[model samples]
Structure formats: structure tokens, C-alpha cells
Target: MARLRRRPRDPEGRMTLSEHLREFRRRLFIAAAAVIVGAVVAGFYYSEIFDLLTDPFYEYARNNPQVDASINFAEATAALSNLISLSIFVGIIGSSPVWLYQIWAFIVPGLTRKEKRISLAFLGATIPLFLLGCGLAYAILPQSLSILYGLSPSGTSNIQQASMYFSFVTRFILVFGIGFLFPVVLVGLNAIGAMPAARLIKGWRIAVVLIFVFAAVATPTADPFTMFVFALPLTALYFGAWLVCRRLDKRKAANRPDWLDVDDTEASQL
Candidate 1:
């Protein structure tokens, strides 16, 4: 019988740069595969997804008599292009959990056991928050379309290209989902001791400004109402995270031994 050979382990159990690259490649391939599978599944439900996305546009056209609005396919391949793009978008969203877990797994190797546990908790929180953001975007789609159409002059037909409209809708939802991830990132940084509650509190004004700016840029429409709708909740989440951090800091300080407070350069009093 032939003897089986074991793969050589890295010295000190630490992965080398080449090993790191290989691991990253593996994770990337898995994530891509998951996305492709998701896309295939989404393709099967293309009609349903199309209707769902176009619902807001139809609603706008139905109620508004001043302007005729319709999504038009300009080219012979435009419908196919839209279908492909929409399927990919749904694929990415549907496979978010798998990709998100892959990302978390990639980072887990470098984290301590405790940090890994904390990160797992955050990862669980992240998926739902992202979906929540997307749902909110879908909910406000009608209002955003209303605001945009309201700006168009009366008697002009708003013939929206199907590809452009779907692109805008997908981008809008993606931006919202990404926007909601910032608070989770903030909380994660706090958990890692990288960002303190005091620092967040001190930077409140700047943070608020930045949030509004992000909301402004993120929303598909230029209107302030959408911006406010996006920004206000995020601002609230920031403060809420700060409060959680503040409590965490207090708890940590209370649990810490007094001797640890002495600077490493100074002699400790017995």
C-alpha cells in the first residue's frame, strides 16, 4: 500500500504571503460561484422580478395624467440586456449571505478567538441590516419616482429606457444597503477598541454633515426629502451605536484592574 503524505504546514502555524493569496483566491472563487448560482435561480423568476421593479413606474404613470411615462426598450437586445443585468443584481443580493460569510471567514484567520466570536455576531447583524436597507429603498421607490417625475415639464412624454430605469433602481437599492452598513462598521470598530464613544460624540457635527452628504449622493433623486429620509435614520443609528459603545466602555473600565492603568514606562506602586 502506498503511504499518504501530509501537506507541509507553515512555520509557527502562520500563513505566508503566497498562502494568504491562495486563501483569498479560494474565497473569491467560492463567492463568485455562489453569485452565479444565485443568478441562475433569479433568471428563473425574471418575469416576477421585472414586474416588481416596474411597479413603481406603472403606479406613477397611472396616477399622473399631465405626463405620459413608460419604460421603453430601445434596441432589439435591450430587453435581454435588462434581463441579464437584473438577474445579476438579484443574484448578488440573494447570495449576499454566502459572500458575506466568505468575507468574514477570510478575516477570521487573523483574529483571536474572542474577536472571531464578536465578528460572527456582527456578521449576523450585518446581513439583516443590509436587507432592511434594501427593503426601505423599495418602499420609497414610488415617492422617489414621484419626486423625479414632478420635476418634468407638463405635456412632455417621459419615455424611460428600460435598461436605464432598471440600472437606476438597482443602484439606488444597492446604495441604500451599503449606506446602512456604515453603522455596523462603526459598531464593529468600537468593539475592536479602535473607535471610542467619546471620539464619536466629539465628532458628532462632522459625522452628521458627512452622513447628509452621503445620503445626498446615494439617493438616485436630487430631492432633499429623499436625502432626509435616508440620512435621518442613519444619524439616529450612529448615536445609538455611540450609546452602546459608551456603555461598553463603562463596563470595560469597571472590570479593569487599577494596576493596569499605570504606564509601561513608569514604576508601579506596591
Candidate 2:
């Protein structure tokens, strides 16, 4: 019987489990430090960040005579806590590259050359796709707010809790951003040979239905227009991913000899 060969270890000598833990701790410390620095910088410009976050609400209020948009803090510590939390959020976003790189550095040594290439490609694609999703959410915010605000009775002013409002906005942005990465994940699966493009294409109708249902549920606004606003881009991205997977599958097939390929009839016989 023949034994399978193990792949070579990384050039850096292997260490005990304790050393790995220490390395992880060091990387975590660096990432934490970067976040702290970012938070400090963000703290200096808290007012600007606050204004930016509240712009959509203000714009909606300005246009609608009946809807008065104002955020209130119910507790004494609410304002300070909210500001601190906002600064932390800003810090994390600002220091994302540093922390992300640190994480990648920690994991890269364990991966093979092909795995490393795929990981790098995935990382490269993920950031921009996430940012684009966030951008789309930001663009949709004004309309979403307007739609929701319109629901209030004519005489009642819309007063929102500051922390709650911030949470909602954060969740909204994150959901959209992460949702946009679905296609990227699909592409990555295809690239890794875990999911075939043909399977994805075959399930197009179901996929579209699920996408729309998700958009409807995920969107904060209770309006069809906003649902479509979220769904349209995702639908486009899904099809785009399908095309990419199809091309990759074709390329992979092209690299193999024709005789090695089995026709459907031959495959059925086996």
C-alpha cells in the first residue's frame, strides 16, 4: 500500500501551541491598538460624524411639513455613551485594513500556495463589494426614511431615541453590505469547485424568489420601491456571479483532455 505525502510546512519553523497563542495575542494587541488610535481620531470629529449620520433624517424633515425629525436621549448617560459608541464604530471602520491585514498575516502561513492566492483574491473582492453595498444602503437611506416618516399621522412629530436610531442605521448599513457579498461567496464557491455554475443557473428562478423575499424582509422601509431598490442590485450581482462561475467552469473544462470527459450517456451507465 502507498502512503500519501504530507505538504511541506511554512519556511518559518513550527512552534509549540503556546507560541501560536502568543502570536495570536500579539496580532490581537496590534489590531486593538489600531482601533484605539482610530477611535481617538474619530472622537476629535464627533460632531461631524453626528451630522453626517443625521443628514438623511434632517433632509426628510425639511421636505415634509408634517414630519418633524429629532433624535432624543432619554438617559443622562445616553448622549455620552452614544457618542462613545459612534466613535468606536468609526474607529473600527477606519482601522479595518490594519486589523484585516493582521488577521490575514496570522492565517496566511498555514495555507498552501493555491489557498493563499484564492484567499487574497477573496479578500480583495470582499472589501470593495462590502463598501459598494454600504454605499447603496447610504444612497437608499433618505428614501427609506422618507417612506417611514410618511407613516406618522399628520399632527404627530417623529421623535426617535438616539441610541435606537443609531442601532437601526448601523444594522441597516451592515445588512445591505453583508448581503451584497452573497454573490462574492457564490463565486468563491465556484472557484473552489464546491458549487458548479450550472447548478446555480438551473436554480435561477428559486434564487430570484429568495433574493426578493430577503430584500423585502431585510429592508427597514415597508415599501415596494425600497424593496426593489435593494433587490435590483443584488439580482444583478447574482447573475453576474453566475456568469463568472460559468466562465471559470468552462476554463477548467478546457484544460482537461476530451477523452477524459464523460458524456451524459456514459455517466448514466456508471
Candidate 3:
């Protein structure tokens, strides 16, 4: 008996459009489910998380007698809402690896072997960098709170609303965490040949300016010190990425064939 011929496959593996859609849906559902599970787990630790989140403010208040720190719920449902919101945020963060893995799995079949290696490296770097950024933000929270709270008139107590405080803290942490990933993205682009080291090096000045601007904007406080705290590390990371890209470009150039070195003008004339 004759055997049936298999369908042709792309170098990166082949799938129909419908198959891709179904795969995407499956991955999305899994990621969502992971987040939900994380949230449920976090809900049990709501009080602990709340205390941990408020610790920075409390610490600042402790040192400064004039500054009064107390979080109040304005509405009847405000406390419950805050707890749920905090749980969701915590859940997403805690389950990041699961969702991130799902995303990577969904895309891996379409990537070349070398691309897959690079992607795995990126994934490894991303989680640590994000956690580092979050840690930095958490470390700076007390100082930031101190500066902002110090601005209030003497003898006046600062009554922070639970919802507003949580929102601010969440936004602050997320901004820093996401901001730190910018360099990883740059490196990934370079690895994929979408961006060359020369371009990044040439645009260093603009990149520095943008980094500072982003830091300033992302910082909850208007203080220059806080802005610098954010910008300095990010700037360092960007230059570090540039150095890596430069080295990569050199390696590529060394391996390139002489015939491939034709000038752009000469190639166009040909």
C-alpha cells in the first residue's frame, strides 16, 4: 500500500491561519487562568500585602513626628475594592512567569533555532531585570514619600486614601519595572538585526535625553533627585546594551564575506 505524503512545512514549522488563531486563543486562556489563580492565592494574604505596601509610608512617618501617616477608606466599599485591586495586581506579578512562558511558547514555533536561543536568553534576562527595577522602586519609596510628605504645612496631618495610595504605589512600581526592560528590548532588536549598533551608538545623546524625560515623567514625585535615581540606572543599562551590540556587530563584520561589503552607492549603480 502507498503511504500518504505529508504536508510541506516552513523552516520554522508550519501552521494554517486558523491553527494560529486557535493556538493564540489557547495561550491567552491559559495566561488568564494563571493570573486568576495567582489572584486567588494573593487574596488570602491581603492584610499582609497591605501592611507591606504601607510600610514605606509608615517608616517615613515614624522618623518625622510632624508627618502623620494613616490610610483611610473614604467610601463603604473602598476597603473591599482596594483589597481586590491589590490582590489582582499581586496575582499578575506573582504569576508573571506562567503567562510569560505561555507567551513564549506561543511564539516559539515560528522562530528559528538561533532566534529561539536568543529569545530564551531574553526571557531569562527580562524577569531578573524587572524584579531588580521593582526592588529599586521599593527601596526608593520611603525617600520619595518623605520628600512629598515633607512639603505639607507644619502641624497638618496627611490623610491618605486607601484606593489612591494603592493606585499610586502600583503605578510607581510598574513604571520602573517596565522602564528597566527597555534595554532588553534594544538588545533583542539588535540580535534580530532590526537595529544596528552604529545607529544606537549614534543616537546616544537622544537616548540619554529620552531616558531622563521618561524617568522624570514616570516618577510620582516632581523631585529631581527621584528622577535622577530612576534615570541613572536606566542610562547605565542603555550604554551596557550599546556595548553588547557593538561587540556583536564587530563579530558579524569579522565573519562577513568581502563581496558583501560593497558600498551602498556601488550596489545601487550595479
Winner by TM-score: 1
Looking at model 1, how many pairs of residues clash? 0
Comparing 1 with 3 on TM-score, the higher-scoring candidate is 1
TM-score of each: 0.92, 0.87, 0.91
lDDT of each prediction vs. the true structure? 0.90, 0.87, 0.90
Q: Write the per-residue lDDT of candidate 2 for residues 153-250, one digit (tens) a residue.
A: 86888999999999888778878988999998998899889989999999999999999999999876678887898899999999999998999899
Each candidate's root-mean-square deviation in Å? 2.2, 6.3, 3.5
For model 2, the run of ten residues with the poorest summed lDDT: 261-270
Global CA lDDT computed for model 3:
0.90
- Supply the global lDDT for candidate 2: 0.87
| lDDT of candidate 3 over 127-187, digit per residue (tens) | 9899899989999999998888888887799899988998999988998899999999999
* Cα-based lDDT at residue 84, candidate 1: 88
Task: State the lDDT at 118 in candidate 1.
Answer: 85
> Which stretches of candidate 3 lie above 4 Å from their native place?
1-11, 262-270
